[model samples]
Structure formats: structure tokens, C-alpha cells
Target: MMIKNTAIIDIGSNSIKTFVIDQEEKYSKIVGFDKSMSNGFDGNKINNFDTFVDSIKNSINKAQKQSSSKVKNIILITPTSKNKNHLISEVIELNGAQIEDNHLRQLNKSMIIKYKTKLTHCFKSHYVIDNKIITDSPIGINCGSLSLNAIATIISDEEIKLFKNIFSKIGLNLIFIYDSSIIYYLYLKSLNLHKKNIVFIDIGSSTTKILTIKDEKISLLKTLPIGSMNITNDLMTLNISKDFAEKIKTKNIDLILNDHSSVEIPVWEELGKNQKQTKSYEFIQSIVTARVDEIFKLVLSSIPKSKFFYSYLVTGGGSMQLNLIPYVKSKFGIELELVEPKQVKGIPTFWNNPSIMLPFCLNSLIENGYIDKFNLFKKNDSFSNKIWYKRFVDLL
Candidate 1:
């Protein structure tokens, strides 16, 4: 028997990554992985198309080499950071027809068609069969009609088309295209966190999203233009390189400690001699504090207070900053929990990094049988074509 290879490519403002898994792997464990620095993108447009294309190709090539398998099809994750809350429902009058998976699939499709949204991440799902209330699923039941109520997250169609063009250039077919925020939400939901007035905040390199789940219904409160990169940009005003600024921001700066008044940084002096430049630790802490404060002010003023409160959770590349949780707790008067997926046993250790949590947890969700509910093979455009692609379908 031949092994079937599947891949997931994640494109974000920070990096382009490739993760591989095959039928031979146990529990959908990631068999191979590689990444390269991303050039940049603004919505549907790539900043440097040629350079970006090369990065994508190189990342995939390296991952394939590591896994020693040619990828049959790919699941692409694009960081849209686009979140619009839309409540939509679709009803199917079966006329005494038995409900099957196809009916459930059609109802989801109908909601997308009528709602005019390209992507819908149903945070809350329900099925009403005939006159009976069913929250789980209506499959295998003979019912007169069924309806699906979904509180979905919507993204623009152009962003998806942008990825399709990239796929064609890379000579790969996509199994599914998902917004990074939705993937984060799915991974968060899979963990089954404490549910009373929870706020799911995903702070990326360039953007931040706040999704409030109150009483089982999720709402997209805001997507702010501010992010961790902005803090790094602010640090650059101290006459330091951006790379050094970001490095210290993530690993060195400690907001919880006030023991130090100034920290010395090594600098090159007059060709060969090395000199130290002293920076005030208080000033460094002030820059980060001000940036986070700005984000809080914008969030509070823009959204309804009724939707924001209690149980705060933070994740993403930005949340990896040291001592952030304690700082947030002390300043905001709300406890901040750093959300991380429990490590899967019997996998390589690098799978546990919080920086790659987006893809790692997504892979876990697939392992836990969440993707089965999506009917991805039945409806995705990338899997719809080609006879050879069917071989990989059984692996799903």
C-alpha cells in the first residue's frame, strides 16, 4: 500500500509555513514542517508577488523533502483577519424525505448563497427537524423539513480569489481555504474552555481581533489595526534596529519586574571596538504599556460594554511576550489567560511552540474529528476536480 500525503500551507504577515501529514502517521500527527519569512500583503494584494511566490515554493519544497513525500493536495490557511458577524439560517423542506449528509451540506451552502458571504465559520450551530428541536445533528432521521441556524464569521470573496491565483502559480490544489481567525476560533472551541462571558482575542503581527462568546452565541466585536509589530515600530524610535527591537520585546523585556532602572545593549563603535548603549528599562516598559493601553481604549470605546467583560483569554504571536499575562492582570483588573493547546504525546518537541500554535492546534482539531463535520471533500473547489485526487479523499 502506498502512503497518501496531505499538506497545509499557512500564509500570514509574519511567515509562510508548510505542515505535512500522511496516512502512515498516527493520529494525524505532523510528519514534516518548514517555514520562510513572508514579504507582506494587504488584503487581496501581495506586496512582492515574485518574491512571495518563491517563498511559498521554497517552504513547500523543504517540507516535502523532510516528509519524503509529494503532496497530493493542500489545505491553505490565509490570514485575512477579517471578521464580520452575520446571523443566517437555511431551511430545507424535505417533503417527507429522509435527511442525510447531503441535506445538511445543502443547508450550509444555502446560507452562504443567501447571505452573500464567501466564508462562514459557524460558532454556534443548530438543527431543527420537523417541529422537534435538535441541537446536534439531523442526519439519519426521516423528517419533513430541517433548518440550520448559524452565527457565522464572514470574509470577502476577493481574499479567497487571491489565494486561488497563488495556488495555480504554485501548481497545487487546495483542500480548503480558511481565515486565520476562524482557524484560531475552531482550535479554541475544541479545547472547551470555561464558557461564562468569554472573550477570544487573537492578536496577530499586524492586526488583532476580539470575538465575544456570551451565552453560546459568538459576536465579532472589533478588528483593530494595532498589533505587536506596532510596538516594535515604536521601539525603533530609540535608535535601534527593528530586528533587535522585536527580539528584546519578545524575550528580554519584563514588565512585571521593576528592579532594574537601565539595561545596557551592546553596540558597534568605530569599526572594531564594541561599546554599550544604555537604555532606560522604565522607558522600554512605557512604550509597550502605552501601545497595549491604546488597544484597550479603542476596544472599549468602539464596542458595546454589554458584550465585553470577564474571562479574558489571549493567544497568537503577540501574546508570546514575556510577563504579559501578569502585566495584563495587574493593569486591566481582569485576569488574562494565555491559551495554548495541550501537547500531543508521541510527536516531535517543536510541535509545541506557541508561535506555530495556529497550525498545530488546527491539525489537532482535524485529529479530533472536527473537520468531518465540515464535509470538506464533498464541497471544496480544490477537491472537486481531478480523478486522482479521490485517492486522498479516503484518507480524510
Candidate 2:
């Protein structure tokens, strides 16, 4: 059987991860994986661009060494640090002529120009044609005028420049750039979950993203600055290294109360001295629980009360916490489901880690033809066609 190779680069707030996958007709195998910490930037801008670029270069090189194929095209996924959403409406007069794809494209282009923001993704809610509402495309239908309602997610231009420069430096072409939340939404929708009014919570090291899907469409996307890292930082007050604190956070710890139970935590002192500290399990749990509670509270407050979601799904590294599911349920009065890459068939067991879920989803989408390959590199020509062409050529 013949195989094709593709690569995915996921730059999150806490880390930069790269994956190389080989896909046949029916299955995909992860051939390479490389990850590097972001030096505490966690998706935010840092003063040292060269250091950040070097980190990305090292990660890509490691993954390349593990793969057999040369990685030419890359799908880049980045978290939305200061993401903004707008419900934009655009109308175009048809003058009793049939609507065409170009007409709809023009309308979309106009909206993009009007917003004047770097758009990450846009989903059309519905189209109004001659007073008739349609969820699908209204192409080839005679209408006096057509109006479209869409939700657009926007990110900072500076962030895009940073990633583009990093990729250019590494001699890789960016075929697709997506907001991490959008990628997660696409992955969940692919699972055939078929749940209406679903809420997705993705917890990362330094941030958490919340997205709501209504009628199988993304209704909201939000990111909060607080994430699992906050809990780890809280544990650092015990004089433990961040690395050790992270290990404790993910070590099947329980949030339930056991007042009399205690666990001994070991730490390294100066001069290579070994020190053992005894602390009540309750104390550690209390520190973690407090931060988690704040995270959930902020999530709840950000979501509008009028919106009703029947199902809630949590994913990402932070969601791997042993008691996160039950704790979220008890605190928010909503049952939460943990999403795992294992749920998707044909993915190797070793590649089931949540940290690589974004790249895995991108691979699946590309292999299944859900997302067009060539179209991934195209830019919107709404404002100026010439400018779009120039930009496209420049990327080449």
C-alpha cells in the first residue's frame, strides 16, 4: 500500500509540539513526535524572539530526525491568547439574479474586510435569501438579496507574524494555521458524538479554552489565563521544583477529603542534599482544589446563563488529572466527560497522549478529506485580490 506523509506543529502556551504521521488509505501511524517547553511564555509574547525561535527549531529538527519523509508542509495550531469573537452580518444584492459561489465568497470577503482583524476562523450560522432562511449554501438560487450571519474568531497580528517567522526560519511552509479551539471542535465533531448543545473545555498548562457547540455548530470560543500551571505554581511554595510539582499534580491525586491521611513528598535541597517533607494529603489537595475551583468559577461566569448545554467534554493535559471529572461535576453541578485520543480508531496507542491531540486531529482531518489540502494555503481575497495574490506568492 502507498503512504503519504504530513506534519503538524502545535504551539501552545506552555509547549511547542510537532508530530509526523504516515497515512495509508484507511489508517494513520504517528512516525515522529517532538516537544519543547516554551520557557514559561505559555503562548504569550516574550522579549527574546531568538530563544523562542530556537526552541521551535530544535523541536522540528528532533521530529524530522525520527521521520523517514522530509516535512515540507506543516499545519500550525496556536492557542488564542487574546481571542475575540464577533457575530457579523453581511448582505449582497443579487438584483433577481441567481446566487453563485463567487457571490457568497464576495460577501464573506466583505465581512473580513469590514472587521479589519486577523481572522482565525469563521462559521456561517445561516443565510437569508429572499426572506427564506437556509443553513446550507444558497448557491444557484434566484434571490433579490442575500444576507449571511457568521461568527468570526480573531487573533493578534503580532502572534501570526511570530509563528510565520518561526516557520520560515525552519524552512517549513505553513499550509494551515488554525486556532487551537477550532481544531479541538473539529476533532470532537468528527467523533460522531452527535450531541447538541455541547460544551468543550480544554485545559493546558497556562490557559484553558472553552467552546460551546449548539446544533452541531460552534456557538462560542473562549480562553482563560488560568490553567493547570497555576496549581503547579501553588505547589512551588513548598520549595519543590516546578518539574516535581507537575509530577505530583498528575500522579493520580484525589480531590475527595481524607482528613487523617497524609502523604510524604520528597524534595532536593541545596548542595544535593535529600530532604523528605511530610504534609497532609488534605493540604496538597486543598491547594490544587482551590485553583481548580477558581478555574471552573471563571468558566461558569464567562458562559451566558441563557445558553443551555446538555453535554460537557473536557480534554487536554490538565484534564488528565485523576479527580478532575468528579471535582468539576461536584463544583458546577454538571456531569463532565473526559475526551481521549484513544476514542479515535486506528491511532497508535503510544500517540494517544492529549498533548498531541491537536496534531492528531489535524492529521485525521487532512487524511479524510474533510479539509482541502491545497486550499489550506490560500488567504481571503476580500479586501484586495492583488494583495492576496502577492501574499500567496510571498509565502512561496
Q: Each model's C-alpha lDDT?
A: 0.66, 0.70
**Candidate 1's residue-wise lDDT over 1-396, tens digit each?**
112577777777767767886654334566678866777555335788888878888888888877766876777776665546565567889988888999877876676566532433444345777856554557888878898866555545555556656777788766566556656656666666667467777677777778676544455556888778888889877767677888878877886786788867666345755667898988888888788777665655554554336577787778877788888767766678887756754334654555666777667766766654542233333434452145244333
Give every collision pair in model 2.
Answer: 13-42, 13-43
Number of backbone clashes in candidate 2: 2
Model 2, 1-396: lDDT tens digits are: 223555677877678877776777866676777777765344666657777777777777787788788876666776555656666678998899988899877876777677533455665555778766545569878889898776566656555565666677878766456667666766665566758678788888888889887766667788888889899889989988888888788773677645457767777677867778888888888898898889888877877754345587778888877677877777778888877665444334654677666677777766665444212113451212454335545554
Which regions of candidate 2 fall more than 4 Å away from where they truly are? Answer: 1-6, 22-29, 89-156, 190-192, 257-260, 306-309, 343-351, 373-389, 392-396
For each candidate in turn, the TM-score is 0.78, 0.79
Worst 10-residue lDDT window for candidate 1 reads: 374-383
List residue ranges in candidate 1 displaced over 4 A. Answer: 1-3, 24-26, 40-44, 82-85, 91-124, 127-134, 137-147, 151-157, 194-196, 268-273, 306-309, 344-351, 374-377, 380-396
